[model samples]
Target: MGVVKDWRDKELSISEVIRKYPHISPFVIIKTDVQRRGVNYTEKALAKVDPDIHQVEYRGMFREKGDATPVSLILRDGTSILTAFSVEEGKREPILVDVIDDRIVLVDQGEILEEVEYWEKPDYYDKFTSSGKPMWQIAAARPQRIDINPNQYCQFWETPGHGCKYCSIAATYNSSKENKPKILNVDDIAETVEEALKEPGRYESIFLTGGSILNGKELLDEEVDLYIEILKRIGKNFGGKRFPSQLIGTAFNEEQLRRIYDTTGLTSYTADIEVLDKDLFEWVCPGKSARIGYDEWKRRLYKAVEIFGVGNVTTGLVVGVEMATPKGFQSEDESLEKCLAEAEELAKHGVSTVGCVWNVAPGSVFFNQMSPSLEYYIRFADGLDQIRRKYNLNVDMDNYRRCGNHPDTDLSRI
Candidate 1:
């Protein structure tokens, strides 16, 4: 949720915000807005989804059970907009994914904002693992990456007031009618990635992220051990000692972090510090705070930088989440100021910050909240980009070609 409003309860329209920030790419702005205020598919738009051609069904992270709805949208310039439709009610007028002149486009109130296309399905999507598990369920494909979620269920949700307020992983898992594995089998993953790599030039990196496994030998040792095992199996595909891979898991201490870096071919690491500020982090991500305090979390990120090296170690921010009600900052101005300052501090230590647009997930505590204005998001994006420039840190691991969910990282293409 990010935008600077010209008046109370009213923010500048996406077009108005674009005109205001002439330097920022309109496609990124549209993607950011679509992320904040979700998207609704027109019948004509949904008709374009061919199960055999386009990537349609997905393993949803939010509250909607996945089916064919064009998993997400992609702009003509290769920017991926990872938006989703929610089953539960939330407040916001989602833009329309409609067909215009026989082409897929994003429309707002009868006006075409930008032409888009559905993500193409990887060849391995329809295939099956050696164990007879669907390959799609083992490794989900992004436009330029293969994602493997080892653990479907997070331990953080077991205790009340310990879960992240903005996350819907628990709600999504508990509400689903289908019987699924809590932790995916290693053989299924290795076989899935093995088949997926056969698709030439389709993937640039392999990403692994899952719910925080708090019960380990030490804090997050179980989570770290799981990634190393899956990675070593995936490493058999390549000859090099280091592969183009990233693991976004719990913030492991130096010892656990070393086990992953020294044992696997993974070249990059990310432990998402969801919110920027320590106080906001505690309120929004109580579980993380309980497991690894905010100060210690930052220290662990600095430790990751030491292990993974610069440009390879990064942290993720759920941008605009600092404005949550009751405990969050009240003004967009204050939230932006607070987040960018913290991001800059991390950058000084050679840690690059990548942000994802924060939308009110259906099952989240903030389901009824409204996001910040579009202007606020654009400004915040530009600020993040500028901070990287100032620190001379690069976001190569999470850029447009690797992970395009962050609107700020998409600007790096320019």
Candidate 2:
């Protein structure tokens, strides 16, 4: 027999349990949890996806979309919840995205959570550029953002056992064949941006990111130069005035940072630290540790605030990764305490921290590891949100409107 709960059972419904923290939007909670658990599609749900109409993988880093896949879903309030292509074994059963009454909805244990819609296929997706490279590969359009990942594979991964454990960039890059030996064509990117902007208010921000490039006369000089050139070209689309854009790139020193700021129309900057603590940072991010060291990385991020100004510069952390086995913290409470402590340290330097739930990818080194618990994720998100509020930091670049990947920033809407 199935278990039934009375109205008094706080655990019966997420609504009942979350009522105490009314400030945290239900949408944010659902989105965070969905990202943490990922989602599965029913056969009926898969039958609903039409590649011609739905925006599936044309050129993505990981997990190609199938006709039966949910193609990613949005909540009733328009918040995007992505199904992590890499999920762990002992985690809770993923929610089933199903087609009910001709509508897409999240079904968990027989209860429907909310209705969802597929992201509209961008017009430029089908149109190929002069070189014949697909526009989707050149640029990916979100509801209100355009993503430009100029480089796909990180050179650090080339070193044996040095890539970030939670990351599957090299494997995904190999499998997808999205990687090329050459850099992405700047002209192609600029042309695609021009075409995407013709959609009439479909986009508000442009995002640029890629794998870490450690090669240069000075470390990352080539990487910085590449972004500056591309940003200059993209800036041409906005008529040379500074536009709304964020560059999630490798941590560069003040000189390189100044070069990018002075040379381009980039309004905000971010460099993902990936993990918070120094010891775990060395173990998980051996490449970054070997090159820049954790303390210097934090120093560079703080220096960015002086150039970009507070609220315009921030750093990103991959939440729950500090709990990886062998070198990770033992208990959830201890991990949360340590994580929040480091986030608070960054916040004091006027740098805000945005967290993405750890999605244990199959191709990554740490594929067999389990992520933190749902309750732990909720508390960790809440804790980070509280820190951001305390510091009066704003995350416009990585916010709900610009980037939908971070649960901590999504709470900023409140």
Candidate 3:
């Protein structure tokens, strides 16, 4: 076990950690910290942003929004840094984007980091859905992926106090519910995806995820049906062939998994376990814990492997949140050991794990809680990558090119 560093051990600055891990890509380390610390642009940096060619706002899954920070960032190396406008409690000084020497760089304190570019706006973003809603409202653009969030309000939030503690979905929904639909209109989704497909090579995958819908004769059945209908509509552009797509939703039973797999054109499956430690999962994701226990969730993931096939299934972890204050693991060493071990267990079952930098968002219950140190996150990402290599598991299903939110998978490019 790595007992060398305590969870509360002095945190390292971005430069210090980068110098420490020479084997890991510095771009990845910078990306992780940018996400961990959150980011905003100076007037000069924002001046370079042309809304006609750059994506200024992103919706659905929670990317920080405020006073037009240009949605998120893409490094010169193509790693996506999904910036949050504000971070929890000002735990770490927010990373800055400033124009220096006629180039945009991510700034930390007085030091300049890397030159980065804003994610480009897709050709379809400026158009409107057939329903008269802006197309960007129906589908958000990632660098090479098309993201469609069918529903924004998680059913888990419907039960007070059950939503994931680090999630802002419930809060994001309540505040915007009056303006947005709880569930998207299927026709709008199909029309937007169809229009997006017209851009040819602009998108590598079509991704769908939304708040979990827990009602049905069998749990997650309605959620399965929802995905089936939407995927079928989008699949029309593919001419009866299975499409490159993924669905991140509730961990459903084998029956539900087969229902979607047998029906839709989705090619991969992901059910975020959130935290690897069972207790941490129970504490951090109370709704998932209550509805689908830890062991049951893993069992469902394994069952997905049987259905989706090996290497096509993966789970995500909110990296540092396993050590969230109070109920979370108290020591970084212990947190790393337990999380890596549990991740290895999942890897053994053909379920590769990916880590999302724990950005303590404004609306989450843990918004005031601090995230883990940079060194801890760097080590965690390397560890998950090593585990996947050891088990011969491939994360291409959600790798850097397909989905850039995960730091661990970004290492796979090396």
lDDT of each: 0.84, 0.80, 0.85
> For model 1, how does the per-residue alpha-carbon lDDT over 1-414 read when each residue is reduced to its tens digit?
442333335778888888888899999999998888788888787777777887776444542323467777889888888875433333556788898899988988689999998888899988987778989888888878899999999999998988898888988799877788889999999899999999889899999999988887788778888888899999999964788888898889999999888989999999899899999889999999987999999999999999999888889988878887888888888888888999999999889888888877878877667667788888888988999888888787788877878988888766
Per-residue CA lDDT of model 3 for 354-385, tens digit only, reads: 88888887788987887888899999999999
Runs in model 3 deviating more than 4 A are 1-9, 58-67, 84-89
Report the candidate with higher lDDT, 1 versus 3. Answer: 3
| Candidate 2, poorest ten consecutive residues by summed lDDT | 1-10
Q: Against the true structure, candidate 2 has what lDDT?
A: 0.80
lDDT head-to-head 2 vs 3, winner: 3
Q: Which pairs clash (backbone N, Cα, C closer than 3 Å) in model 2?
A: 46-68
lDDT score, candidate 1, position 104: 89
Ranking by lDDT: 3, 1, 2
**Per-candidate TM-score against the hidden true structure:** 0.94, 0.91, 0.94
Per-model root-mean-square deviation over C-alphas: 3.2, 4.2, 4.1
